[model samples]
Target: MYRFLLTRQWLITLLIALLLIPTTIKLGFWQLHRHEARVARNELIAKALTATPEPFDSLSPAPGTAVPADLTWRAVTATGQYDPAHEFVVRKRTDANGTIGYFVVTPLKLSDGKGTLLVNRGWVASGDGAADYPPVPAAPAGEVTLTGRMRADETAKGSGGFIKDRAGLPDRQFNLINTEQQTKETGAPLLGGYLELTATTPAPADQPALIPEPNHSDIGPHMAYAIQWWLFTAMIPVGVWVLVRREAKDRAKQQAEPEVTPEAVPA
Candidate 1:
């Protein structure tokens, strides 16, 4: 009975079963690894947020800075005048309640004279009936202080046309990665990266307030996914065995049945 499985058809089926088991196991392990990575990242972000704000000089933007694994989201301070004319609206930002809007970002000139830094002030809803840009209350004249997390500069997407620099403030567009194109268009010496402002006092009446909760990290699910994949891999052999047994039993039953005989007829 087992020798029949050595036939070409059974051999191919076995080969396919063998191949799928490892593939399923690999996918499960991959998910587990992702879960572990997310957990680790969550821990780093939590640590960075709780720590005291460090000077901009203390941190450096090395290559691959955007990797969430390496980014440190900490409280940092900067004194600058927000350049309202050069402001850009990051389109299609959704809030906690799923309301869609835009994030107003502008270049804030640091008082230290080091350079300008991009500030993501907050969000504004686009109401019905008209495409009106929300009034950007002037950044108070003279120097203003801002505290937020330091984010790495955005990078260009594949083929690079996804983000383009416009002559003035963009009306309707989407940018996946920050590019120097916007700065060049504005003719502003914008900083290399952007800052996500968390607390803005005397809040702007029109924009949504920033939420300060740190995102959570969980790695338990990855372990579960890995186990599931391995289980799938293990089930293949059991399934094959059951199928072979059923087929053998059916053949034996057919052989045991009595053969029908033609009835004798008068010639």
Candidate 2:
């Protein structure tokens, strides 16, 4: 009964089914992990966002290379002068509604005058590139203060690579939020992390519009996706069994019938 499974097509089917079971199971587990991570991040964000703004240096010292992983998303404040010459636009930022735009990242020279901090002013709509650059408000000159959430340097995490300066944009344009990379451009020591500018002291005449608040409530469909993949894995063997059983039945019928021979005739 099982001999048919050794045939070319049946064996191929068995092999594919065997391969898919573990693959689907592993994918299902991956989705579950994604869901769990989202939950943990949300819990962290809920606490971090509400906390009072603290001095930037208190979280991490000045002229540092990277922010601690656990300290990200915490509210922090810094005071410095804008280094407009070193400013660059971070492209492809989007709003909560999914509008394509760019962020103007400017370095804030610490009042101590020894180092600088990158302040992401905010999002601005992209232009037709008929001109040299996107229209963004200039960072104020002289001493200024900034307040916003803490975000770890992009290089600190192994998320993805940054797309370097794009073509046809203004002179100073970048595709990364990586402070480490931008620090090299600033020609000054950096504090390892950048501020997502929320407010400024003595509000400037111009400022980038606020970026959309992050969505923390969505656990996404990972759990359901995982279950669906697992369910499909479970059905693979059932399908193979159906085909094998039908083939066996056909063979049985052929064996049950008697073979007929032509009657001998005068030759």
Candidate 3:
């Protein structure tokens, strides 16, 4: 009865099952890796947020060099004059309330005259027309000291992910808060990382809302997904066993049936 396992169809099924087990196991491990990475990131963010604020320039000394991954979300401060003339808005950003808007990125001229730093002031709702610029509150005038979380520049390879860089956007509109791009636009030397403005000295009467700290408490569904994939991997062999048993039983039932013989003496 078990000989049916050697049939072409069953052989193919078994081969497929063999292939899927390892594949599914690998997939499960992939999800597990993602889960581990997320947990580590949360821990890093939590630690950085709690640490003492440092000078923004101290975090990255070289101009235009990318911020170190471990320093992301680290508290930092800088004293600078807001250059509103070169300020630009990043499209497709959202507020804490999940409202679609643009992020106002203004270049801050360092008071030391060393290099400028980009500051993401906050989000503003879209205007009546897509081409029409949204009314962003003016940056506080004069020199000011501000504290914020340090963030890596938004590039295709940066924390922002693989965002496509498009051209021909509206006036003063941008895709990402990249120091390299902004350095060229402002015609000024720029520091590596930008700041997500949290507070400023002599706060303006009307300023864009401050961005909130990112939630690091959530680890997401990666672990659950990993368990599910592993469970699916385990079920494959059990499923094949059930099929083999059913086939064997059917064969046995067919063989055990009595066969009737014609009556030989009726003629």
TM-scores, all candidates, are 0.80, 0.84, 0.94
Misplaced by over 4 Å in model 2 are: 61-64, 112-114, 128-131, 155-170, 258-267
Q: Sort by TM-score, best first.
A: 3, 2, 1
* lDDT for predicted candidate 3 compared with the true structure: 0.90
Index of the highest-TM-score prediction: 3
- Report every candidate's CA lDDT: 0.66, 0.79, 0.90
* Cα RMSD, model 3: 2.2
lDDT tens digits, residues 1-267, model 3? 599999999999999999999999999999999999999999999999999999888886477788999999999999989999999998888899989789999988888877788999998999998787999999989999999999988886653575677889999998888988877876788889899999989777988878889989999999999999999999999999999999999999999997756874476
Residue 248, model 3, lDDT: 98
The candidate 3 region of ten consecutive residues with least summed lDDT is 156-165
* List of clashing residue pairs for candidate 1: none
Tens digits of lDDT, candidate 1, 165-230: 333444633443253655555665555556778865444454444644556555457778888888
Between candidates 2 and 3, the one scoring higher on TM-score is: 3
